[model samples]
Target: MKIAVCGFVMGIANLIPGVSGSTIAVIMNIYERLLNAISAFAKLKPSKEDTTFLFYLGVGIVTAIFAGSLLVSLALKAIPVVTYALFLGLVLGSLSTIIKRVNKVKPTYIAAGV
Candidate 1:
């Protein structure tokens, strides 16, 4: 269920300009988990349980991307303003979560680049 939701979020994110699907995954707190699951595929003796879970998760993500992209494309063609507005709202909402997660910058950190 969680993976499906993340897939949906990622699918929508990819449809929006200036919004990265990877960034959405990061904001959703599943970035590392997703990466780890993909990396595990390279192992010689990969865990059977993990493989099975990843298989289903991958399917969900693929399905979401296919369905979401089609819906978004159609929505943009039929209602450009409303479609773009909804995407803007989603990006803004997700950005707030990302901003909160960022560490506060210290004077030294800022000065280092200058």
Candidate 2:
């Protein structure tokens, strides 16, 4: 379920401009897991478990891409502000998640980074 949700978030991130699905996975702290799972294929030596796990994330990403193209884009076309709001929410959510990852998040450092 978590992997599926991450895949969905990644798909939406990709669909939206100026957003990175990889960044979302990094924030979600699943980047390493996904990297291992996906890299196996490129390396041409995938383990059975890695193949199964990636299959799930792949299904999720593909499903979201299809749904977003079909439904989300249609609605976003009709209501453009909705797209902005969704993007804002994703960015804000990602920022919050990133802050949590730090041992002691510094406002000055974050401000500088931003």
Candidate 3:
């Protein structure tokens, strides 16, 4: 159930520009498990655990993708500014999560790159 919900959030994240589904999975701390489940399909033998986990996650992701598309489309049509602001917030939130994981920041690195 928890994994399903995480999948749902990941789905929603995918709907917005600049938000990655994998990044959402990483934020939820299921990135490695998700990756393993995906890679399992390519192996000669796959485990029941990976199959079951992917099933629930896939269900959530597919459900949200369909539902969120309609809702997000409506929101965008009705209130473009608010919808964009919400997307910006999602991007910023993801950025902060990434920043939090950084062990150190170098002034030169910041200065050297875009």
Candidate 4:
């Protein structure tokens, strides 16, 4: 139940430019699990847990993407500049959330430049 809500919010975040879906997943504490689930797709068979989680998350994300697009379109028609400004704010504000999710910074990671 809760995971679905989190996924939904992540979906919305993805719709907003500059607001990374992975950043929201990290904030929701599902980034590692989500990454693992996605990455496992290359294998012949993935675990049931990964498949189930991805299924629910995928559904939530797809639904939210469609709904959010419509909402954004309406908002743009009503107030284009304000809607874009709001998205800008959302992206800027999300930086703090992203920072919190950064547990550590190592030399290796720095070298990787990610």
Candidate 5:
């Protein structure tokens, strides 16, 4: 159930531009386990636990993505301004976390990016 909820959150996060499901996984402290599970599948030797975990996570992610798409579509049609503002807020909120990962800053790089 917890894994499903985590997957659901990740799905919702992915609905937002610039938000990655892996970032959500890392925040939830399940990134390492997720990688292990994927690696197991890659080697075609997934354990029973990994199979079950992936099943639940996949279900949650797929369900949320479909449901979220509908809701977002409606919100965009009904209240486009509010919906856009909300997305913008989400992007800006993630910027602080992303900026923290930067070890160094170069003025030329920043200027070039801009």
Candidate 6:
């Protein structure tokens, strides 16, 4: 269920200009898993189970993207402000969540870089 919802959200993000579905996935906490799966495929000897799982997951994501793009494009054309407002809220909320997860006052880490 969670995957489905995230896929739908990514689908909607991809439909909007200036919004990246990959960015949305990153903000939503699914990017690492998705990237890992992709990287696994890049290996010469990927497991059959992993390959099958990725195949199904890819189908679900593609289906969601197709449906979301069609519906959102029509709705945005009819109500631009509302659609923009909703997307803005999503992005801002995601940003706040990301910030909250960050550690503050890492002077040692900063000094190591310098």
Models 1 onward score TM values of 0.74, 0.76, 0.89, 0.81, 0.80, 0.69
Query: Model 5 over residues 2-109: C-alpha lDDT tens digits?
Result: 999889988988887777888778777788889999999999999999999888888889988999989988999999999989988877776666556668768975
lDDT of 2 by residue, 1-114 (tens): 777878887887788776788988897778998889878888999999888778777777888898877776687789879877887887787777777777987799879877
Better of 2 and 4 by lDDT: 4
TM-score preference between candidates 3 and 5, better one:
3
Clashing pairs in 6: none
> lDDT tens digits, residues 16-75, model 4?
888878878877889898878878876746899888898888878888888988998899
| Colliding pairs, model 2 | none
- The best candidate by lDDT is 3
TM-score of 5: 0.80
By TM-score, who's the top model here? 3
RMSD of each: 3.6, 2.7, 2.2, 3.0, 2.9, 4.6
Model 6 Cα lDDT, one tens digit per residue, 1-114: 566667667776777665677877778787887777778878756677557656655665787788887888887899989988987886677656655666883878557635
Task: Rank the models by TM-score, top first.
Answer: 3, 4, 5, 2, 1, 6
Candidate 6: residue 47 Cα off by (Å): 1.8
CA error at residue 83 for candidate 3, angstroms: 0.2
Error of 5 at 101 (Å): 6.8
- In terms of TM-score, how similar is model 4 to the real structure? 0.81
- Of the two candidates 2 and 3, the one with more favorable lDDT, higher being better, is 3
Clashes of each: 0, 0, 0, 0, 0, 0
List the candidate numbers ranked by lDDT, top first: 3, 5, 4, 2, 1, 6
User: Would you list the C-alpha lDDT of every candidate in the order shown?
Assistant: 0.76, 0.81, 0.88, 0.82, 0.85, 0.72
